[model samples]
Target chain A: MTALEYIRCIGESWPTTKERAYFEALALKEHGRLSPEHVPEVYHFDRTMSLIAMRYLEPPHIILRKGLIAGIEYPLLAQDMAEYMAKTLFFTSLLFRSTTEHKRDVAEFCGNVALIKHTGQVVFSDPYRVSQYNHWTSPYLDQDAEAVRKDNLLKLEVAELKSKFYERAQALIHADLHTGSVMVTPESTQVIDPEFAFYGPMGFDVGAFLGNLILAFFAQDGHADQVNDRKTYKEWILKTIEETWNLFHSKFIALWDEHRNGSGEAYLPEIYNNADVQLLLQKKYMTDLFHDALGFGAAKMIRRIVGVAHVEDLESITDVSKRATCERRALDLAKMLLKERRKFQGIAEIVAVIRQF
Target chain B: MTALEYIRCIGESWPTTKERAYFEALALKEHGRLSPEHVPEVYHFDRTMSLIAMRYLEPPHIILRKGLIAGIEYPLLAQDMAEYMAKTLFFTSLLFRSTTEHKRDVAEFCGNVALIKHTGQVVFSDPYRVSQYNHWTSPYLDQDAEAVRKDNLLKLEVAELKSKFYERAQALIHADLHTGSVMVTPESTQVIDPEFAFYGPMGFDVGAFLGNLILAFFAQDGHADQVNDRKTYKEWILKTIEETWNLFHSKFIALWDEHRNGSGEAYLPEIYNNADVQLLLQKKYMTDLFHDALGFGAAKMIRRIVGVAHVEDLESITDVSKRATCERRALDLAKMLLKERRKFQGIAEIVAVIRQF
Candidate 1:
């Protein structure tokens, strides 16, 4: 007999809870057509009870965030994540899918507006302004939080990204792609809990993963003890960030090239047939995407520092002052990335900036 | 009984024909929420028979194109069109409505894919490539047509615009808003025939109107006789183009200000409450929108000249060579506008270019 993992809403089941259940089930059910290896198989979904039963990872599969906190390295983490993001983002985009099929899904996924609005508030809005739900390391970061509200340039850039999140339906994205959403066992990686899935900018997903990894990297200072200085671990995280984006870019381009003659409606094969024009288009597309990923990734990093929901990486540091130091670094880097993201040409440049910090 | 105008599918009523009837009726039905004066009331719609009945404009309100071709100037044409475009586009956008409401309609309008695809082929695709449906003034425009296909920069710009049209669901736009789709007199303007309506880019409608007017301007020489040189009429057309865009810009801004505290989800009032920030955001928004309008208008003009659908303004010129000359001029202007639209800061600059042509 097969074992099934059931996710049930135990407490008061709000409309949003039920909605997420339905959407998550639909996402898993539809995963077979895309990259199915990293996604769990849906067995049964009971909408009324807000319950979902799916394949269980079992055994050594642990949440990626917990593993990061424990100083564990997954050698295949970057490659696996790159494969997952490239497949999910590229295949669902107009470059690989027909407009008709894409729009239908876009409309359907817009039902995840509950979570989208929540994200719009907590991630993009609340962190930048005074909100009842917002908090940090209290006095240690009080000035930093206030400075965020007063920064006009940061506000302007964030407004641009927020509007893009609301408007651009580039692909079906796994909306909440933080490390906590992934389960890994060195050789295996599984992305779970796609309750927030929707057709949004592909960079949102790419940025989420990269941004969380950066957060994990910053928190390593607080985690360091006598045994491990965490210097090598930090390098590994930066390397992973660089490799994931580089690999995703190449893989996405490869898919575009392979499917140039397919039903993808964005660039007709007849128009973009020549080598020079293809290179130009690819360069522009990837450049814009790279900038977007950096901007959104930075935004994600900022939210974790001061927003309502935060990661365990920084929270685990018993000393509040030390945790605040790590958070302040992440927050400063995020603000800079959000503002000066367009100035960055590649992931290596981003890595260099991180090293400087 | 009130006079009724019934639009019926003529022959071979395909699924697309029935789809158009349903969407057109929905467009007209929804027009009441935005601008009422410029739109005829929808009386009845039959999906099965592909028929629509609506209020009819009186005889004085001749089709705008016919009036333009005959050298008759409607003073209110620009004002009425500006009002129509601003109200319809603003009210239907996330700037004025919640994201949930907006996405529902966006999904519903995805059913208008048939016309959208047809538009993709004719306006954005077929004009720049070889298709059996493509035919210009032939011998006269053979080089011009060939030139369009050969111009790498023009093709690159068009592909960008095409992808935007396919992707950006900014607002509910009148997908076929050429002068022919409008009826007008010296005192009044009434927009009709929204069979191609969908939740697409607002600039598409604005561009379609301006592009057609530009076409009419280019065709005046062919229509010139001893009685009317059309020099003053030409100036009026250019003035109207300038007025329409400027008025739309101001009206759109006014609406945004009035509803700044409303339910618009795109720019939250709480975030953009300050005057400096508000001014900055509006500048960026309006600037991007202006460039989009210009690009889309240029594409519309080029398609009419070289694609499947030829405008009556250019077609009615009895002298074949004369008509060819007019088309060639319009084609040249459109190619320039498409390639260099970003360099233009104001509608007046665009008017200056139109005059130079």
Candidate 2:
């Protein structure tokens, strides 16, 4: 069954009447499957509450965060990720053969994904925002909290300035498909937590995935004990970034070529048909998105270290000097990412430098 | 004689009629000595051209760049620069004890400083509209014309941004007062180049001075050949930056206390009475400006080496790799400056780090 139908089943399984009502409403609103013609079968239990049920599909998957912490490598993982991102973001949003109404429905659904509010606040904010989390935090980590706050403020301001950037409604995006939210295998990847999903910058998804991988790679220094393993682990991280970017670009272009529909034709011309112009546009968009990604990634990395939830990197490094060294390197890389993101042309270039670290 | 009158004398001595007319108009507009009451003199210049001039006090001085390059340290140089900048930028703009008419006249005169225009196939446009000085050309220098073109272009862009920033009428600024422009001795410092001056961000001048000094410090690797003298020379450079920042802050606060006069009361109410608040405001401004300065300095340093005119610093390093190392260090420091500028509260912090390098 489709992802939405599976979510409906989970909602129906909730134990209480209030829970049933809340889930049903949430499933409809959050899933954007509210059309009368498309509504799933509604079941009633003891006449107390109504629920929706549907078949669920399970596929080979692994938690991205677990893989990161464990330093596991799956061949073509970066390539697969880039492809997945390119399809979900660039192809689905920019090249989808969908009607305007269909696209709008997707956007509206993604907007109501309250799971983001729940998870983002819980996982992201609790550790950083509360007083309890402030004490006994890493000293190096604490130094970055004010910076994180300032960065957040800046992003909010940028978001305000570029409000129109998200106005062109498009397909549903798996917004929070970073390491924690994505389940991956060799052949297929399943993205969970559609709550943070939204129609936004296509590059945002691409960046989030690749950025997380980079973060994981950098954090290895905190976890790995062997110097030799550290080198190999870091190599894997750089490789992931490079391959991911390459695969994403290739797949994005292919999808655009294969699915050029007439929708939004008046505003955005057929980008695929004109190779020179298309390449130029793609490079420009990618470059700008990369800069944004770098800034956001720095914010993410810094916040995780100091804001609320500290990473395992520093925790694993028992030696204060080593921990400080790793922290400094991570921060140095983050700062470099933010400042020099524009100067980089492709992910390979950036990954190459990161590898040197 | 006042600075304007001295400049007028220099203008009148120019061999070319075009140059003479330019300076003559400059003197009239800049020096309030030629008043609205002297309608005939003003009208004569008005008919001839639109450029304005002003008269101001002159003092014994020498360019800071020459001193830096030559490794000469005049006593009280740092204190002198701080006083000149603090008095000219903060006092004249915010705490001036002058009448409204006099302030207005000065403001108008500042507003009229000429902008350099890009004419024809010239790649680098002059934005300051200052008459080119044949005497100012470096005989010892061998500059790449194309590189110079590129550097000029970059400088032009910077100058344009600076002018636009000034047009907001934010504060009184000595728009152009680099080492070449400012004349100084142990007892006093005098700013020349009112030709390109305007009201703008006060920090721009601070950044220019400090940034240039930092560049010189880095450049000293080549300038002072002896290992021991190198240490001494580098120490001087570091001390200069530290003292310059310290004196500027101390004198700035002192001036703010003496004559703040309710001008910046809106954003800085407590600043009128609270020394701590004033210090914090100054610190924040300095921090932000330092970042910009580093970025600009990096760009300037890099362009000088790779693009057009090379610094004597690299010239002193005969080995290619060594020179590259120095260049690389400058670039690295530039990036570091951009990245960590916000973290620095005092010049000692910067000097400590530079000394480590």
Candidate 3:
């Protein structure tokens, strides 16, 4: 569906039957399963608008935002997230492995992914010419505004990253998989609000999740007064990052080992040979993704500070010195995201270092 | 007329009526007299061929080549050539000094001047490519046929120099005043073959003359023995260069002082008193012309050696060392042309130094 149509459908309970159909076909091809319960049912209200209704999965679950606020740290979270992303984005997709003709077809399809294009346009294009959004604001910022905005944009651009991560096939991804989008607990995790879903670099989803947690940790300066408590909170942020990466890596490897159709003679024996080769290839792909993640994370951080809907993290700090300090730290982290992207082996390492700063 | 028609006209006659008419108008503006005898007449015999007819002023008025062969030399030759060029190109015609509208008309008239484009089609075009000249039949050339042919093609692109030289309206120049086109005597020098005459930069005319002289000097080794008359021959070449520039500068300044129409207003008071600003402006113009002459001269020299048209001076040197030495010296002169172009204060100084090199 077109961007305007999608937005109208979301706001006015219009039907999105055609959009759901397209996603279902794609999901079946990529995931080998069509989760009807997870996808929306669409009904046309008018030629230009549609209503989308879905089975909203509730918790024993918590959105990523609530989890961040509640300090609900998960084990090996960063590793698990990275592994899920690498497998989903690279090995399983036809984009990196397909014939030229098939790759072109997929590229064309992904190019028109409306949600991705729409969000980018809304964020980057002039608001006077484009339909203004609540999040739209001038990127030309003052000293404080400039600092935060630049930090975010730098994270998104990843100017210093050694390798590009956009060569892989972009599937229909839940692009905004931040705290508010994810509903999770200790044993079970549920993702909701797929309205912002689109085909994009998988690093985007990973970056959003990690970026919001970093934001919350910095916001603690205004929220908590005890110096000792602040140090503990900071440690928790580092632990959460390390645990996320470990969990994501273990889970992804297990999935690949159990489900892969390795006939021991399938195509590309050279790539599939031994554990060392596999690890090397995986490491290269992970490193590239880390750079892209840093760039996207910076973009999100900057937008929240100078964008129209300012975040409460720095705004809540009331005192200019305290607020500036929080912002300077966030900017520093964002800069590090771009400058040290290649050095980061896993999400845990990056998160661990960022929280300490 | 188109390029084809122009080439056809030059190939068929001694004096081109059209060429004469064009130059006569220029002469009338400068000398306040129209001497038809001084210009060639142009005529079209067919769509593909035409001819020129004119008084072939002969004997004591020998072409520059005959004098070179006889080991005779002229003093201040470069200066004489530069004045002739400056007078013809800048002063005599509306070619360089014309308004935009007038310039457009003149440019259209001279559109067929590019020799390379016309030769390219005749030499390399499909269906009727000329193969007779493809073989390395030149007993004098040490290089293979393909290398020589490629070098020749490169030299042809030097037509680009026209654009650079044409921007400054410094003189009414006889655009092709090489040795073959001029007839000279001790008392007077009459520039013949006005077919290539156009409103162009003063340096083009100056460069063409100096460049041809350099070519002639280099070709002397093939025409004469280095052991028998090398020292005396070299001295003559050097003197010719020094004398050429001196005469050209003296004549140019004389003309400016006698006829310049400035009303005692200074354009460059810092360089000269306000009362003689026009003379200073003229001097500045001559300096610029010298710089351009140097650049074009260098390009012309380099193109002939590494490019096409192997000079006879090096051709006589059977030993590669001697030939390469001559080539190296020529190149050094060419480089000096480029490097010291801006520092040149007068024609005599440049000519004198270049002769030593």
In terms of DockQ, the best-performing candidate is 1
Docking quality of model 3: it rates as: incorrect
lDDT tens digits by residue: candidate 3, B1-357? 111223323333333444444443343333222223233223222322233333345457677666665666665344555555545543443212222232333333343233222222222221011243232113423342233233322222222233234222233455555676666665445566544444345666677677767766765554556546655776677666656666666665665554434321111122122344344455555676677776676655654455434444444456665555555556556655654566777656765665676
Across B1-357, the per-residue lDDT of candidate 1 in tens digits comes to 244575545256455777877888899888755798899887777888777777877777799999999999888999899999999999999889987888788888888887888788788888877889889896998999988887778888888888778778889998899999999889888898887888878889999999999999999999999999999999999999999999999999999999999998887777676899888888988888888889999999999998899999999999999999999889999999998998989998998888787
What DockQ does candidate 3 have relative to the true complex? 0.01
Instruction: Give candidate 1 regions above 4 Å deviation.
Output: A1-12, B1-14
Candidate 1 residue-wise lDDT, A1-357, digit = tens: 234685545256455777888888887676534777788777778888777777888768999999999999999999889988888888888898887888788888877888888777777788876788888999999999888877878888998898778778898888899999999898788898888888888889999999999999999999999999999999999999999999999998999999999999888887676788788888888998999999999999998888888999999999999999999999999999999999999999999998888
List ranges where model 2 is wrong by over 4 Å. A1-61, A97-99, A110-136, A147-171, A186-188, A226-228, A261-274, A310-325, B1-357
TM-score of each: 0.96, 0.41, 0.40
Candidate 3 local accuracy as lDDT?
0.47
RMSD in Å for all candidates: 2.0, 18.3, 19.9
Give TM-score, chain B, model 1: 0.96
Candidates arranged by lDDT, highest first: 1, 2, 3
Error in Å for residue B170 of model 2: 28
Give the clashing residue pairs of candidate 1, or none. none
Q: DockQ winner between 1 and 3, please give it.
A: 1
